[model samples]
Target: MVLGAQTTEESGAIAVYHSDDLKSWEFTGVLEFDVTNAQPGLSPDLVPRGYMWECPNLISMLDHSDGRTYDVLVYCPQGLAQQDEHYVSSDQCGYIVGRLEGSTFHVTRGFTELDYGFEFYAPQLLSTGDDAITIGWMGLPAQDDNPTVDAEGWVHALTLPRRTTLHNGVLHQVPLFPLPDKPQTQGFGAVATATCEHDETLSLVDAATPRLSTWHAEGKLLIRRHLPTGDETRSVVCAPGEITAIADGCAVEVFSQSFALSVQIFEEWQNWTTETT
Candidate 1:
């Protein structure tokens, strides 16, 4: 079996390894890649030259739409400069869609943010014979001032299990339903319609009125989060679409056709309300 490891020597690389059995391993080398058309002004999202790339996850998906398979390299790149479409926190997680040609991976599309919320990183892809499933951590690096650690003595969380697919050269992730454990009424769920009534605004909040929700606005998806550290907002430029957000006791994952967001919330999710303005 061939596995990928995180390395940073050659521009955010993934070190490849070979293993005949699960127990023994051999250090092969860095996974070589051909960044085809991935450059400044050529690609919409420039491939971040990360100082460090962590948690390398390599997975493949068959785009049934056109009957073509694509390999996705998911990783967390640190020390990225803030951009209009990138994350404010440099440690954002994202993926590259490409095809593996022999020993070299040919990058078809550049880097794209997997999540646009306040906290998301280190996504793992699981091959289940038929589907590519993903789950990620809902915490950022070096920012652990969450109230849960002081109040509940707990911290960090894994995102909802999601099935991934590739459509039109883009990755789509949908949560697997009937999750074993939901927030147990200690959390909340809401859906933001693709398009609200003309000249209307939809707002989602909990008993504490934390801005832990997403809404469709002006051809974009906007997310707001109220954390112990501070309040922040993130937006994605996409065609108007509906969004579903679910928050259990510890974490919240927002779903949309354009992006998926997983964030940690310590606030009470009871008595949730959606307001129009």
Candidate 2:
């Protein structure tokens, strides 16, 4: 079964298609969800995501907890209202864990956001052996004021490939390859580690323009940026004993034991210096 989304703002849903020979295909039906009635006991207070769903991906995986295989559906939703506090991004990507029966998914777990960041969407998943690897667009939807647009004439990039694993009814992601620990000085990529011995701040700056910074203090992690008009920030609550960050050109991705964040730094390319204090 190949899954895709019908782009509609009002009543958007996922379209299902089937193929037997991998060359010929037939349109099946649509996979629709009613947030009002989904997971009444588990997620009774949850609300609908948005008006449209896009970039739909469906895959099956074995649940190590119960020895049952389940299907995971991942998609990006659009047209989310600003007043909706349930989601962080105006356009968000999430997943649903369920079982598929005849082109239909009977969901077992409620919706969960895939990445808690400012620039994560349109994720594509690939299955290798028993693991699922995903790569996402490191950009947002319907935004055109990026600094890279004026400085570099390009505004988007791809995130580093991440390995996804389902454990204890929750999904965890990490970089597919181990990151370098040695300090880099001349390029757009760098790696840094932080500890909880005291409150710490990690900043990447090109001369005076602030690209991005990560602050870890009081069991909370904050990603801060200094824009031309004001400061833009995104935060997550996690007690990270040690945190790792990887920056590539205009994209920065951070990971800890409890959470992860991926953001696109719009600042022009320069020899960024890493500061710790």
Candidate 3:
């Protein structure tokens, strides 16, 4: 078995290891990137440079659509800045789609965000039957001001398993199964569904110390929160249609057919109700 790991020391690059048995392993070599000088008007997102990479996951899959097999490398790069129109989180999880040849990955397409959500990181890919699915942690690193830590003394949860596919050089995600129709009210979590008319709004409000709200506006889905720390909001572009939101304590993951967005809620609201119109 071969494993990929992030090295904090040395060059802070990704290290590859090989093992004949599950117990013993040997260090192979580091993944190398070719660097080049860019013109003054070029955007930095076209370049890949980071201080350290974390949560390196490498998988080889056969794309039956084109009858070609490719290697996908997913990793979180720490301290990388975002430029241009790329929506990258502070600690972003991205993937490199390429070909693996004898311990080296030849880059076909550059890195891109695996998810545009704020709380998506440390994603793991699993294969079952003939499909590849992914699960990501719905928490941000170095952020520890959530109300759940004080009220329940817990901080994080895994996202619902999502089926992932590569289409037109982008990764698309969808729920593995249909979302539950029953209303859920367990602990600080809730699941709500809404079907929108043309340009309508769907609202979810949680009453108490940390209140949360989500709605679709313009061409984007927006999430706003009122936490003890402060008020904040995050959004992503999506087509107007049916939407579903799954809230867990201070974090909520919103899903649409095209994309997904996850945000943290932190304020207390007096009106504890949800409405869709």
Candidate 4:
């Protein structure tokens, strides 16, 4: 799979190709820019006359559990920013979602499923049939201008891959291995183990679960009663791994392994907030 900028005569464009038998090949045509339609959704006077697309990548996510399939693409657009320059500065860098129809591929999804924070760029994804793995270049045009990055040589690092699942029509993500291995303890010991009264607010110290607000305790993990606010922010806390907040009807379940902990979110309250030792 290939992704790149629609190029023009004055600039270079990135392209991709694949062959099964090495002797025959089939692929998407190159994406080069042209002055006529080079800049999407831009005024003619403000368009960057000549620019090239950088890296392009693609991954396929074909899962039977959810019964939906799609491919992901990542690429960079290299050109002068809003202000044109003789030398290339940079342009938008992010991932795009697409679908494959036999030998024809179409990109229909844009990068809205990204963190709104000021971090992450040049993101990429690799689909393993069950999951579409993602990573990104921490460094970007903004980072290059920052003083901290100038001294560090490396201005950024890829975030841990997250597994995305659509639950009740809303998308949720969990760090592949969301929970930490530490056990919630009591007294002056490790972070997870703590004590709290029945009706009180406590700051979470364990990094194993999401920040939680609850009426009870379970070792180091937190258990919270999810309240409805018609807001996406209303969620359970399951630190290090997945953020577990009770939605219209969802809660977290915990289980134990040798040295690590595993957590699962469920709609059934019966096993939602269990404390298995």
Which predicted model would earn the best lDDT?
Answer: 2
lDDT of 4 by residue, 187-274 (tens): 2122332343434344332235423343233332333332232211211122323222211111122211101111122222232222
> How many residue pairs in model 2 have overlapping backbones?
0
Off by over 4 Å in 2: 6-9, 32-49, 64-67, 82-86, 182-188, 196-200, 204-210, 216-219, 268-277
TM-score of 1: 0.80
Q: How many clashing residue pairs appear in each of the predictions shown?
A: 1, 0, 8, 17
Query: For each candidate, C-alpha RMSD in Å?
Result: 5.4, 4.6, 5.6, 14.8
Q: What is the model-wide C-alpha lDDT for candidate 3?
A: 0.64
Q: Candidate 2, 188: how far from true, in Å? A: 7.8
Which of the two candidates, 1 or 4, achieves a greater TM-score against the reference?
1
Tens digit of lDDT per residue, candidate 1, span 1-277?
3343445455566667777786788876667768865432211454565667788787787765677777877878777777775657758688777887655778877778888777888888898653588888888878776656655566677888888777766678888665324233432354333343323344544734655655556766777776555767777776655556666655667777847877766553332222311
Give the Cα error of residue 74 in candidate 3, in Å. 0.8
TM-score of each: 0.80, 0.80, 0.74, 0.44
Clashing pairs in 3: 208-268, 209-267, 209-268, 210-267, 211-267, 226-267, 227-266, 227-267
lDDT (Cα, tens digit) per residue for candidate 2, span 130-199 = 5599899888888756655655576678888888876544567888887666756444377766664336
lDDT, each prediction = 0.66, 0.68, 0.64, 0.38
